[model samples]
Target: MNSTAVSVDRNRTLKMIAREFYHGLTSLLFPAICIVCDQRIDEPNTVVCHNCWSDLKVLSTDIVKMKQIPEQLDTILPVFEFNDTIQKIIHGLKYSGYKSSGVHLGRLMAAQLPQDFLLKDTVLMPVPLHPLKKRERGYNQSMYIARGIAEISGNIIRDNVLNRVKNTVTQTHLDAHERHANMQNAFAVNRSCDLSGIYSIVLIDDVFTTGATMNAAATVLKSRGVASIRGLTVAAPI
Candidate 1:
């Protein structure tokens, strides 16, 4: 073996050892715990333990298709059922400052999609959050989800093109009709964005309730000549 190649191998091994040592030290000082169960998490890069992750109900493709997809969207893909487990995880992500949960769920969501679901020319677009609400939250949760999906799907995210024009109230207690009304005219596309070359878009969000939010965002993109559009969410109500 050449001396140069041997030296490169030694450097790579040294770097890997350094990383492992750092992770071990960090884990010892600050133990990771599951978001849902509050149990210690031994996994290197996850907040939820394997058992809690297994408890999440996976949605069948047929069931997802049966759900109410907004007319503006061609279809919607949801990963998990919106049961008690999901509610807790989402609550943490939205209210408890656990933004990493979004990314964790997003990767799982994207991994289940068909290979062609996200094309080379397609981009990920997060449902826009109002500037005021975004300031309060300190970050947009959907952006993290999109980032995670992009990591798995190899697609670019186009969050800059969509803006939430309305500071709509929370849809938590609202009926389906009320949600629809609240999201009307809630989104507007930026006129300066060059979307002509974009072939498709997949909207990412944390949850799917009545499809009201996704529909409102899609309406604006459709007006701008975006022909192919769909929605992806971590979970949806049964």
Candidate 2:
């Protein structure tokens, strides 16, 4: 066989061996039921069973568009809902140890953005978290989601432009008016930095409930001469 064929064969062989090893390990570690559903996973890697996988209602853009993005905020897109499955997944990522859930949801969110939207000039910016929250959580979930979106979208992620001045309350429980009040004066563009000419931006976050947070961020970016600032999130509580 040629060198390329040999390499392919080697990779296939390694994959088979790895699969067997993974199964063996999981057999010992998770010889019980899946967490997502009552069905037996029989493997540590299988947190969700086939039945639960089917139960996971990945919201359609049509539903997301109708429900989440209000008529006022016209430049946003959401890929899921803050319903049962998404709530669980988001909770796991934000509160629990399942960091991978953020990346997974981020990739899914990025995929929903139009291909033309992710050109070479586009920049991805995640809403900033306060220093206190960052220290407490050890990682910013929005940053992780932005990183994942950047990986697939090939857009440059601007991680430093925006800074959070205060540790605000959870926006989940707030109404539209309360959300606006809560997020007002919360974010500020770094005055020391300059992106004088840069325009197109893809703002990323985990959820879009009232859109006050996104509107606040967009206002800051627009003031700095950003031509277009569009928001993309994993879920929207409509």
Highest lDDT: give the candidate number. 1
In candidate 1, what are the lDDT values of residues 1-238, reduced to their tens digit?
9999999999999999999999889888989988788889987677778888788888888888799778999999888999887888888888888888888878887878888888888889988799999999998999988988889888899889999999999898999899999999999889899889876999999888788999999998999899989998999877
Give per-residue CA lDDT, model 2, range 118-191, as digits (tens): 77997888888898988888888888787778778777888889988867898767788898888888888999
Residue 48 error, candidate 1, Å:
1.4
Q: What TM-score would each prediction reach against the true structure?
A: 0.85, 0.77
lDDT against the true structure, each candidate = 0.88, 0.74
| Model 2 ranges with Cα > 4 A deviation | 1-27, 31-35, 38-74
Shift of residue 31 alpha carbon in model 1, Å: 3.7
Candidate 1 regions off by >4 Å? 1-30
> Looking at model 1, which ten-residue stretch has the lowest summed lDDT?
44-53
